[model samples]
Target chain A: MSKQEQLQQLLGELKAALPELKEIIVASSDGLPVAQLGESEIATRLAAMAATAHGLGKRIATTTHLGNLVEIVIRGDQAYFIAYAIGDKGILGLTTPAGSNLGLVRLEAQEYARKLAGIL
Target chain B: MEPLKIVITGPVGAGKSTLIRTLSETEVVDTDAIATEAIGKPTTTVALDHGTLRLDGHLLHLFGTPGQERFDFMWEILAEGALGILLMVRADRPETLPVARNILDFIKSRAPVPYVVGVTHLDQPKVWQPEEVALFLGTPLEHTQGLDPRRPEEAVRPLVRLLELIGTNA
Candidate 1:
């Protein structure tokens, strides 16, 4: 399968696993959208912002001697926006409804990020 | 020492980050990532590039905004309370002039600060002159000049001019 197809399939599986996820975006390290599910209109902007967050997170990690960056989570009053680094060249961003299972979401997202990294 | 905030903005590959790095006295904080598109550069700034320098005994905090439009929201954030702006445009790439103009308009609409346009890549062949760029950007010729961002002395011309426009000598 093509890389795009693989990415879509993985995103599909992730969505199925976490029905609470409002959105999923796969973006290149440079802020370009690779794949997205839900709200396609905001995908471009969200992907860019996700990459920016990932870049800033990596910098923060290095500056504070916090070892490798794992993820960046922005908890809003209504929802949660989480970004994970998929290897060095990609990022995985997800939005989940507030009150969702945070620990489970992180676990599943991290696993999907790893699979996405391999395809990227 | 008084702190003067100056914002450096331009399109991708216009040398915003390079200029800040060349002019900064302290270590620059940059958020550059590998570019997915072939924009003639390997990496692009996703967030902001921050640096500081002392100009005429005043501490200048320089913030370089990401060049892509998707990150344009940062322009207003960085331009907040900025005393002046230095907009960089690649002289060799006239096509980017419109985008540069849009960026200038967006920031000036919010901050209404003094600005100077730095026309980089003058050393390259088939490049636009500062006057032509100024005309296209609707900025005064005096506020636009060609400079090499990689060179310390040349890289600082626009900032100094911006400072002068802001009624401060650098």
Candidate 2:
């Protein structure tokens, strides 16, 4: 299968595992949404937010003398957004309801990210 | 008591927050929290995140800087009072070396603090060896170690050694 098809299959697998997951987006490291699952509106907003967050992460790394931007988790009243970098140019983002098992979500997302990185 | 300020910085997905969370279990204050408060918003830690831990009666203040370069102003403030820096590099992508160098230059220009590089994501085969990375970055061989930023034990030793090195230098 083509890499894009493989990534789509993986996303399908993830969605199947966690039906509560509202959206899964493959975004550029800069936060532009490359591929998304779910409503267009939600994907658009998340893409922008992810890009902004990624940009902010890079700025922080440079100033603080740390190293790199890894992942970011933001908790909201109704939902939560977690963005994880896939290599340098891609991010794996998941939007789930509040109180979701973040540990599980992170693990799944990370696994998918690894697979996506291989294809991307 | 004075806090031993330490700053954690790295590129996107390099595991800075995970590193800070692990370090918080050690004896240091969370500087990233302080930076968050300073920004007055949940996502606006434009400068730093603060945490603290008490180790051997010493209160270590930990500062986590934002990973983006545009928010550079915060680095100056966070770098103040820092005894040393723990530079976290992603082993998966050596391209981050330039970003690491940029941060190192900023820190060197602002302070004479000793630094130790922690190479994260060693579990991934794409990551480079610590020795090769050290040579690539021109950092001393003794100052770099392979680490898993997700695990506290793996992340903290290099930082502790950095503190010890700073103490010896002083």
Per-candidate RMSD, Å = 1.5, 13.5
Docking class of 2: incorrect
Question: For candidate 2, lDDT tens digit of each residue in B1-170?
Answer: 76788888766456776777776855422223112122223332333555676665567777887665644555666787789888878888888789888987897689778998888888887768899889988989899998887677787778778878877988
Interface RMSD after interface superposition, each candidate: 0.8, 10.0
DockQ of each: 0.84, 0.03
Model 2 agreement with the true structure over A1-120: per-residue lDDT tens digits = 987788788888889878889989887553446778888887865764575565566666656877876778788999988887777557788889997887888888888888888877
Q: What is the TM-score of chain A alone in each candidate?
A: 0.98, 0.86
TM-score of 2: 0.53
Report the C-alpha displacement of residue B73, candidate 2, in angstroms.
1.5
Q: Model 1: per-residue lDDT, tens digit, B1-170?
A: 88999999999999999999999999899998988888999899998999998887678999999998988878878989988999999999999999999999999999888999999999899989999999999899999989999999998888778878888533
Summarize candidate 1's per-residue lDDT along A11-32 as a digit string, tens digits: 9999999998988999999898
| Candidate 1, superposed: residue stretches over 4 Å from native | B168-170
Candidate number achieving the greatest lDDT relative to the actual structure: 1
Q: Between which residue pairs do clashes occur in model 1?
A: none
Q: What does DockQ come to for candidate 2?
A: 0.03
